[model samples]
Target chain A: MTASASERLTLVARPLDRQVASLSALAIVLALVDAALPTPLPGVKPGLANIVTLLALYRLGFAAAVWVSLLRVLGAALLMGSMLTPGFFLSLAGALSSLMLLAPASRLSRRLFGPVSLSLIAAYGHIGGQLLLARLWLIPSDGILYFVPAFALAALITGTVNGLLAARLLRRWPSSKH
Target chain B: MRLIRPGDVAVFTLAALTCGLVVWACWTQSPARTLSIRQGGALWREVSLLHNARYHVAGPLGDTVVRVEDGRARIESDPSPRQYCVGQGWLEHAGQSAICLPNATSITLEGARAYDSLSF
Candidate 1:
């Protein structure tokens, strides 16, 4: 009986932790890849890591998706030596704001809300959160508003691309029941 | 499930409209070229953004040093207990502001936009 109980924790807790950790690692790698890409603007990027987040959301659940995003931000910050900086906070704000909005939208009937819509919502929330934080703390100026149009356009494009990629991956992903 | 759904198109269209609206609104806004300083709730002075100088405004506490340089302005120092105005850093764009409630002095960047909510 004692051995079986110990096995339960190992089988359940350990696997979930490992799964979340692996997903987070994948997201961190994608983030690093994104950083290496050149862009016309400072803040605009493809946001490739969001693909993993969408996968986690669709596969495991929203809680697992949250874990992946949180770990990705922390791990990427440590790797990039941006810990506790404004950049780090901006990333965190973006992730949390996106997830906060993504949660309810995910609950929408699956027939209508797919990866594309969720991705679009997440992308917009991310930029909105970053701008809000910048206006409140860092820049504290209306100049930040000027960047909105550019950021929104970028989010729209990137969100669509990421959604398509996620959808394709989902087609091949094995939907094994836990 | 289908990769592209009608709901996705609706979301995209709505977002794109919003993007266009922001672009137009931002484009129409004239550059903030003036800084208005008020003392004890009355208009005291208006300065051009081109000026590079420091001002000493008398308030309840003491002289609050307002610095303007390189097309930006800031409350550099103050006699107040908490230096929140000083902490606000710089005022660069239209609608930016810093209020020194303890000193009864404030500065606002004006010259563009119709809505006051954006300033907040």
Candidate 2:
């Protein structure tokens, strides 16, 4: 009876798990695409991948957003063969720092903040975190500050554009997905 | 159905203002005052960028003429086949660098606040 009842201890995937998996997969795809997209300047990226995280946060809650974002970073790194590199750490730092501001601000007043504001905040946080890490471990010189303004400007543009996209996506998200 | 809320304007204004402040502050770093030249990965000399000057550096490829003026430096002429160093235009920022790899010579801009030791 025991052998029949408990054989192999079958695992069941919860709805939250499925949601997180699908969302993370989408994010990772975007991250890879962003990586392939060329920029005139080093360290400049459009960061369209974070749109998935924003959508997940709005629909599935903070926990789902966190899982989606983290998994996306890790999975993309694995696919890109950049795991454990300094570049990987930079991505992780940016993701975590942005999330630090993202959930609380979004939960505070969704009516006021919406997606654009949150995207801008995340973009700045991402750049700030990467710059700090670059100073501490990579460049190891005040010369890194030379890049602050350029990076900040890039973040502003990308953040706003991505945020707008997320807003439109959120507005159009399918009822079936909900 | 609003594309941008009132709070979105606040966020945009705040972000733009902060970015402008950063731009002004970074751009205002006292102009670079030193130009360091290296030959074969060794320190050749440090020239004053505050005034115009010219120096000829000899290498395996031949002479490389460096002209410094208007707080800017450049490889006025290089004997390297590609002329890539000469084509680099101007070196203006604190961390700007031009490496004439074939000629075994390089130049870097060094400001009061920051100096880039890495040249490539």
Candidate 3:
């Protein structure tokens, strides 16, 4: 019985490890791609990698999704040589805020708030977190607040695009019903 | 049966409302012609937009000649290597500004505050 239990444990662990690994790798690649894309303003990106997080959230579970996001933030920071820098902190803050929003949002009935709404909320949370951090540590002036309108507008555009894409992808996702 | 659900519509409406509010804030806020000259982060002078005159302000590098004309101000000349501030031409709008980095002189057009300040 013990031997069989260990075997089952390994079976479950292997697939879970693989899922986390692939999801993290995919998110990292998307993050690097987003970095390569030209942006109109500093701290603005398409956040394409977030699609992977949303997928993991909707299909796999919130825990898996959080792991993917945390790994992606750490991995992207390491790859970009911004580890332990302000940039790393900003990414970490954004990812945490995204997860914070997603946690509560996940409890809502699936029919009323689907992937699109959740994704949009996560996106806004991400931007708002980074902005708050930047204000507290970097600028600390009313001048920095002036960029709120521009940043908010960017967040809305990017959030909508990401949310719609996530929604479409989730529809085709095999186990999305979970 | 709709691909776009009610949630999607709600999100879109919320985003549109926020954008509209931002646009309204920008549009309704009048451009204040109050121009302030600063040197090394200190306020050197405040020139009223009601009057049009030329004034010389001392800066880190040397002197900057500022001219206020018809509710607009410009750095007519500066001692900087490149007359970049002069090249900026004019500062007519409330949010416009011209800076001579080398000379450590800046002219900014400031208006009334839209809000008290953004809270963390």
Candidate 4:
């Protein structure tokens, strides 16, 4: 039995790790695509890469989702040449906050919440974290808070769209419960 | 499986409430009719945006010119390096502002439609 269990871990873990890497790669590509779009204001992006993270959280669980998110943020930051810069720090803050918010959310109501609510929560957490970091480290002024309305609106719209997309993807997920 | 679960509906309702509240707060702002200039972190002067006038204020680096025309304020000229202040162009919106870090001078629109908040 021990031997079989060990074999099971080896076989299943390998495939899962490969799946995480592939998802991370897809998220990285999305991030690069988002970067190519022109933003009318700073800190405004569709954040499409988060869809992969949401999928990972639902399918592969929290740790795998975290790994995918970090890999995407790091890989994309490196590719965009923003590593170790303020932009990287902001992205890192946003990703970490979303992961933190998603952890308990997934456990609380896996059957009820679904992807839409989870996506909305994570999206708000992400933008809130980035804005807080920008206020504290990047610009030391209350003047920046004026943009919260715009940012909040953007977050709501993008979160809903991303959530819908995630829900669709979740519906199409293979039925054989992994 | 359904596209949206009961929980998704609840979340959507809550999100909608939050968005509506934000929109109301943002749009319900007083219109601005005055322009305030600050130097060295102090209130240097306040000018009426209703009148088309130009004022030259002494800045840390040199003289900076602020112009108000047709209910809009803008930094017409500045002797600061990099010309960043001048690039800000016209400030017709309530929360719009221009700052010259080198000269430590800033022009911010004020009055009825003043900002409920400012983004850094």
Ranked candidates (TM-score, high to low) = 2, 1, 4, 3
Proportion of the native interface contacts kept in model 1:
0.71
Best by lDDT: 1
Alpha carbon lDDT at B3, candidate 1:
78
**TM-score of candidate 2 to 2 decimals:** 0.69
In order, what DockQ does each candidate have? 0.47, 0.39, 0.23, 0.38
Candidate 3 lDDT by residue in tens digits, A29-117: 99999989998887889999898999888878999999999999999998999999998899899999989989998888777777777
Instruction: Give the per-residue Cα lDDT of candidate 4 at A33.
Output: 89
Please give, as one word, the docking class of candidate 1. acceptable
lDDT of 4 at B68: 92
Model 4 stretches astray by more than 4 angstroms: A1-13, A175-178, B26-110, B114-120
Quantify how close model 4 is to the true structure by its C-alpha RMSD in Å. 12.7
| Model 3: lDDT of residue B20 | 71
Interface RMSD of each: 1.2, 1.2, 2.5, 1.7
DockQ of 2: 0.39
Per-prediction tally of clashes: 0, 0, 0, 13
True contacts kept of 4: 0.61
Tens-digit lDDT track of model 4 for A1-178: 3465445443455778898999999999999988999987888888898899999988888899999999999999999999999999999999999899988888866678788888888888888899889899898875576677778778888787898898899788874535
- lDDT of each residue in B60-101, candidate 4, tens digit only: 789999999988988999998798989989887677789988
Model 2 stretches with alpha carbons more than 4 Å out: A1-6, A174-178, B31-120
Alpha-carbon runs more than 4 Å astray in model 1: A1-13, B31-120
Q: Rank the candidates by DockQ, best first.
A: 1, 2, 4, 3
For all predictions, the C-alpha RMSD in Å is 11.2, 12.4, 12.3, 12.7
Compared with the true structure, the alpha-carbon lDDT of candidate 3 equals 0.83
